[model samples]
Target: MENFDEQFSITKTVEFIQKNKSTRVILQLPPKLLQFSSKIEKHLKKALKNDKISFFILAGASTRHCCVDTVSSARVFGDLIVHYGHSCLSSTAQIPILNIFIPTKISIQNIISAFETEFSTQKTKQMILFYSTEVENSISGLYLQLNKTFPNLKRTLLNLPKNEKEKVKKFEQKQEQEQEQEQEQEQEQEQEKEQEQEKEQEKEKAKEEEKEQEKEKEKEKEKEKEKEKENLKIFGRVLPITDITQLSKNQLIWLGSSTNPTLFSLALTFGAENFLVLDPEKEYLEFEKMERMQPMRRILMKRYALIEKAKKSENIGIVVGTTNPKKDLQIVKYLQLLIKNSKKKSQVISMGVVKSLKLGNFVHDLDLFVVIGCNESLILDQSDYYRPVLVPDELDLALNHDREWDGTINLNFYPNHDMIANLEKKLKQSFDLILIEQQNQKQIENLIISRSETRSFKGLETRLGENKVTKIEEGLSGRASQYQDEIDLN
Candidate 1:
């Protein structure tokens, strides 16, 4: 050999080191450059044949100038320092430091091939290569060569490393300092603008307040005029129920002396022309002369007539009612006689409180009854009829009854010597019944007027009064407190 260096190229350094066994190749590279560590390791391993050869990679931030201090430290520790990506090193590093420079062309090819392999596509039709502006010219030259090799591809150049986010952050901080000074200068101007706007807003607010006061004064004047008109009307008019029978056809009327003011207001608002005062002392026929009747009673009377017509003409009528078993049985007998006396076209049916009528148990078709309860009770008693339903209590008791009957009841307690008028007023907000020591003449008259209006007799059975569905004692004690305690424990 001319000399050892002349005979063997430095490329064979890995093989020479491997031949000596116990050789350790410690690679020191920039932290960012270590992204190629896997490829570097693979290439070095391929160049060495000895099984005893060892490799160590040390990465840090100072590799831009090939960190001399780290190289010396590695050498003192008996490890060969292979500094990658740099062509020079500091003179103070006494250790043997190998400088390796990746060929620019080779680097470009490697990068492109790596990207193609990762993305699984051969089409590099449009690409933009970015690098530090200081190195942009070099990369641009490489891009030109690549374009020649790949004629179908298009390339765009960008200066990137210097424009990276961290680099731009420093520039932004400097600009922000300048902006702060400018903002200080503008602060006085902005404060003056805000104060001027606020003064204008206050002036507008004062104007609006003045306008509102004037509007309120106008509203008061209008209210006084309305009050005067109402007083005049009240003095000129008569009570609605006094001569209700003399009212014209299709005329609306309100009954009852103790009618709710709110209800009266609602009726007037909804359009009622007249009101009819009822007298309980008056007979049913006498009230009919006045053409004034209770709503529920009117429904019952119409239903009764329909039932009778069906029996006389269509030979079909259903009787549905809840009554004492004895009374119900007698009513059914009377209905049977009426049905038998009619023509063959007439059919009479009845269901009593028997509770079990098999084929005849529930009669849905009906003519009339003295005491009919509800739609469900009627359906249960007479499943065969299709007639207009009539109920006592305007179906109030029927609708409000619990699905399952319980035994709890209500007892009315009043102070001593309470009049019916007073008691009725008190109970009006709560209960349906009026409890008093002695009923007033007007109140009794209203009650009788209400009863005569009834075409069917249905009332709450006091024997089986109010009942409780839920037991109070069964509820948990301080359930919410217990929940909070459990949460605190957790």
Candidate 2:
């Protein structure tokens, strides 16, 4: 339904394939975008007509649609991949990818009017701008324009690849260097003679500069580590932002689809009061009503209730909702260890996508389920579930008696050092208590045998309680429907 030529740069994709000299290219699209595959393929083939080049369109991803399908590309022997639709901008280790962000048109004037109407009263409050990745191409235009009117406004930017203009400049520079290669060679001799003359004079200065550079490099390494600690990666998108911790205090202006799940995740992470949704498609700003945020707050309440329910549970089912085992395996094992230390039984189950019906089969076996997956998959609607479901954070709160709830929800499954330390202490205590109980049972058994020594003179009759023999009777042998008790009168 959407125009491929306007929204996506098919020329850029063609240039990328040509640059890479890729014989086999993979075009990975989400399910919604599959219908446009023929049109996309036709355009690509018309633009690039190389006999050796072959194109393959992967209908859907192996895992979540937001994630890049690297495994599929490898299966198809693809050298380059062009991903369509919305992406989390997650870094992939296997293959190089070009993400095509779908852009939607929005009136800058309308947005400014909405902003003024909402924030005209409070001019001092700083706001953070967040938009879905689909509208990323428009965000630069929106951000630059919005900052002209509101000087204090700040927006988080993704670390994107080089633009077409930069690429063109680099290509031109390479061509210019090739053209001037003979001239540069002629000047190289002159430059070498000048370099030799200055080398002796600058030798001592160069050593001192190198030492200072080493010291500065060390300082930079420390700074980078600190930066790494500050950066937060949620739902696979890495946000190198500082204001995220202060989100509860600051106002958030969300620009994207109203039905985006990330919007709800953000609201649940921070309070809903600070959120203002500006839907470009709907062409309105939703802030004053606050009715839309009610469902997210309700989700928070539901998750909290599930935590309480999880605390009382005896058998916990740790559901692995991610296909990537390396990322979630440690989390699953850690949860199991924590539940075990709490004196509860835990079982690890793997499912690509967790469903109510699949989990319902274990309704009789499991008391509650703790899902270990990405941030997007962790928040599930459990209204249809017979048993309650929880994320790793809730599971941690439920199992750990030493820790208290901080009234904040974190969807990231990575546990910190403090939690690990607390779990170790609890484990030691549980083991000590278990050993004490075992010793007490052994002592009670010895005491029972000692007490029975003087009162067992009556032999087997004392323990058996004087059994009496009785005659056996024939048992009824008929179907349940024609049982003796239910027979009709004859």
The best candidate by TM-score is: 2
lDDT for model 1 comes to 0.38
Candidate 1 displacement at residue 299 in angstroms: 99
State model 2's lDDT: 0.72
For each candidate, the alpha-carbon lDDT, in order, equals: 0.38, 0.72
Instruction: Score candidate 1 by TM-score against the native.
Output: 0.19
Per-residue CA lDDT of model 1 for 1-490, tens digit only, reads: 2232222223444643433232666666666568867666666666665556667766543222323334324543644556564322222233344545443222444444444443345344333221221222245555566566444443322211111233234455567668855765576477866577765675688679869967986897799676545431111122222232323332332222222232233132222223332222223211121223224334334544443344333333334333223433443444333333332222333333323232233244433332321112322123343333322222212222222212111111111233323434443533333334235666888898998778476665565556656656644555775843255653
* Weakest ten-residue segment in model 1 by summed lDDT: 405-414
Q: Point to the candidate with the largest lDDT.
A: 2
Q: Give me the runs in candidate 1 sitting further than 4 Å from their true place.
A: 1-22, 61-65, 69-76, 106-490
For model 1, state the Cα shift of residue 55 in Å: 1.4
Scored against the true structure, residue 342 in model 1 reaches a CA lDDT of: 34
